[model samples]
Target: MNFWNRALIIILSLCFLLPVFAADKPNILILGEDAAGDSVPRSSRVFKRVLDALINQMHDKGFDVYDEAVLTLLENNSSHIRRTDSEIIEVARASKRPPIDVVVIFQIYASTQNLEFNTRINTLLMGRLLNVKTGKHLGNFEIDSGKNFTGPAQCQQECILTIVGDKSRILANDLGAVLAEKLVWMNNGDVSEPSKNNKMVTEYALIFDGFNAKEYMAIEEYLVIFSGYTRHRPIEIRHTRSEIWYQSSIGTAKLDRNLNKMLAELDMQSIINFEGNTFTVKRITFRNKEIKENNEVW
Candidate 1:
């Protein structure tokens, strides 16, 4: 091919590949929670309206939002599945769709006060941002809708509609901005330095079941050199179960892989499970005695 023809081919190939290699914006999923930290039904009118408002705000900020209806569909399709905050993670992990990077859990509280002339409606919106991949708490925000005076005969539902319609944008904007900034920092792996404490650390709960004292000691020795390990304190140590408060900069997923790999290397058959910031290690036994341990490590 001629020089100019070859140059044109190269330029066309670059154009086609650039978009594929571009960095994608993080995917966000918003969920509603109740006072007891349980998942609030999305069917509630208040929850639906507030969720729509938040979704609009996020969209305006150029974020890709996951439809909550997909979660409902997943639940309905699975007979044994019940939707909850923690269960959402497991469901997301099992699905083949794009992974959810951040989850926003929000709660809404509304109340009315009676006055001689009219009733005053007040609403409070509380939200928390969590990083799904690392199970890290990003931040929390609380926003209140200023007093809205309505007729004395105004019902709770009418009051909720009035206040939420008027203040939803404000609430969404405040929380959305914070969430956007935190997402950037998390994506860049930039954890803020501790102001009060001199060290940067995250606390995790570690539990071991069916391991002997000698095995526990060996595990501790390995932990001391684990990646991002700072320190740990033993809460309880027993043959049946043991607990330790571990401090590290790494997430539970990484820690789980590391511990399991160490166990295999030591010829200890075990199963490691993790939920959020807690990890549980259980020793497995086999009668054949010829079973092979997994050689894979992440």
Candidate 2:
């Protein structure tokens, strides 16, 4: 009777702790940058508005989002913005700033054409998400809007400005929805936030080979699905072949073995071998038999 009572107490305690553990929301950083390669402030303004809209959307979806401007000011004591992926990730890794799980890079640009009686303007927004720990690009998205104003030439410029702002907000909301879905997928799966003792975790170097384009894509799909389970980054990738090198926290040999089993279950012929802190993968086939035969004739 005492053992049964103790077991019940442990179960109840875990049930209570689980919710608290899951409530630790992931931090996301949104960085806006110039893309026009000019002094024009249009790109900056559009990006700012889009960032604001994305933040609101993420907040509603229960995410903790930070703006680049605020982060820079707080960490660097300046309001300067970083424009590239490396720069953005560098900021996230700084000890002074709050830990970030994901980084969203956003850029906007516009083009205009003047006509005999009207004007046409097109604006585009491009965004991509990166894992802060692995430096892996999870996904990318783009949205564009075009408008034509056939009016008393004077008001044409005003119309274009209004359209730019409106479309920027719409694009931002759509992008946010897509990002939210990705986060939902991660949260529902084995992917967890970076460990607090990540630095203390041992490091491993891994190699994956024998993958063709089709098989590589298959592996990437699995990575995207199981990305939450491990924080690993590819150090080198051979685009024309089936090989990649990655660095990751140690003790992932079991994870790699599980992946090999999962691939075999999917009928992909691959084998993974692990040593102290290094592993290798070799695939039996480059592609499906039918696809290979069809390609051989070409």
Candidate 3:
């Protein structure tokens, strides 16, 4: 096709794709917490690097991701102020920076200090998502990235020797990727709307049908950044029946609303299990479907 013909085809394609593109972008926030003085001893710069990777990736993908992990931790220290959904919204909007459309808040409990020989850190990071205005905990999940996953041979990385920077970029890359995916899922994964009949106005049970940290991470940076939507609350990896309740709330952008609808369109299905050359995306039906997708051995 000639240049003019190509231009005509491009315009037609955009007309078909614009509605999905024009949907609002949720401004996501990242919040990390520890019990006051008990924070990881040398973490001032650690998180910021991770923050950059996540935000940069998400930005490239299409969402407006904000780094608010620092401020939220400071707020957690204050006693009198009860963080309401509205306050969350204000916090998001108050940002001379963009508002945190969806939040990735984590209260980490790490057991790396207890190690002796081949020091392995077992961390239980409970990641919670909140709507900025309402203090509604959209979803919460446990992100368990055990340092032991690294083989002894892999531990030979000379660059991984820093006591403070013990966790390698590879680990960070994996964790960041997974977290990014979950962030995406939280921001965009299909959510079964909480019953409006409830006396409480906050919605509960933000779910990803089948959960895989990596699966969710791969798409997170891409969708939220490129798709123009905020992340919903991210749920942890677990097996349970009852809805995961919201511990706090935050207001959402117009993009978040559309994300919920997109997830709903996914039929609320997600990847649940990983087997050799096979993967499963589950829905509420509990019926398992195996899909054959291509993968290359790099």
Q: Give each model's whole-structure lDDT.
A: 0.64, 0.60, 0.42
Each candidate structure's TM-score, on Cα atoms with residue i matched to residue i, is 0.47, 0.49, 0.38
TM-score of 3: 0.38
Q: Assess candidate 1 and give its TM-score to the true structure.
A: 0.47
Stretches of model 1 off by over 4 angstroms after superposition? 1-24, 35-41, 71-84, 146-156, 188-298
lDDT of 1 at 80: 32
Residue-level lDDT of model 1, residues 183-256, one tens digit each, is: 65555643233211454456677888987554676788899899888656555556557787677877767888
How much does each candidate deviate from the true structure in C-alpha RMSD? 19.1, 18.4, 21.6
Task: Assess the local accuracy of residue 109 in candidate 2 as a C-alpha lDDT between 0 and 100.
Answer: 67
lDDT (10s digit) by residue, model 2, range 60-105: 6756576665555554222444345566678776622345667777
Off by over 4 Å in 2: 1-24, 35-43, 74-82, 95-97, 146-159, 189-298
